[model samples]
Target: MSGGGFSRLPNGTVVVAVSLPSPLGDGSVARFLVHAANRARALTRLRNLGLRAVYLRGNAEPPTPDEITAVLHHPDGLLWRLQGAPAAELWHPFRSSSPLRNRWA
Candidate 1:
């Protein structure tokens, strides 16, 4: 869990959770997120984990090329930039379970 890499669930799913340090500072909390794989091999690794797919959540944004390189090189030095807004603004209130369903409709 301490390693800076993806983990597998019991269901053969490749889960890349962002295990960045806690307390991102400035009254905001850092959240761990699952990263998706665009490569077929990475997806296969997920399947090997006995999972059909991994669960990804939160308002985490995709890392930029430079950020990715930084993570690949020195994950411990990974630092994310604040967009100067609340994460809730990206999605509606999750009163119901199927929040995204209504969003698509």
Candidate 2:
């Protein structure tokens, strides 16, 4: 899933899909899949990383089973990309994504 909603795994964790406008103010949306113990924690993880605009919307795009697995196995429990980005685009860890940094410099 790429827009919103969450899925519970067999191990009792959750994978949440969140979409928000990029911090760069470029009219582009950033999508994220986060694996956490629950929904609040998932959002909190993003917020803690300076993504304050993110929130769970309706289940417009829930993470697919495969997408959940991808987030689950990620060490930091997060994967991100620009919405509508090419399929060949990479999903990056939040810390390294340009969207979170101020490009003004």
Give stretches of model 2 more than 4 Å off.
1-3, 96-99, 102-105
| Every candidate's lDDT | 0.34, 0.77
TM-score of each candidate structure, all chains considered together: 0.25, 0.80
User: Which ranges of candidate 1 are over 4 A from the true structure?
Assistant: 1-26, 31-55, 58-60, 75-105
* Deviation of model 1 at 31, angstroms: 7.0
- Against the hidden true structure, what lDDT does model 2 obtain? 0.77
For candidate 1, lDDT tens digit of each residue in 1-105?
111345443556333433222233355323222333332454343344333443334424444443344334442322233233464433122122433223322
Tens-digit lDDT track for model 2 on 1-105? 125898878889889988766667788887788999988999898778766666787777888886777787789888887888888887777764454544412
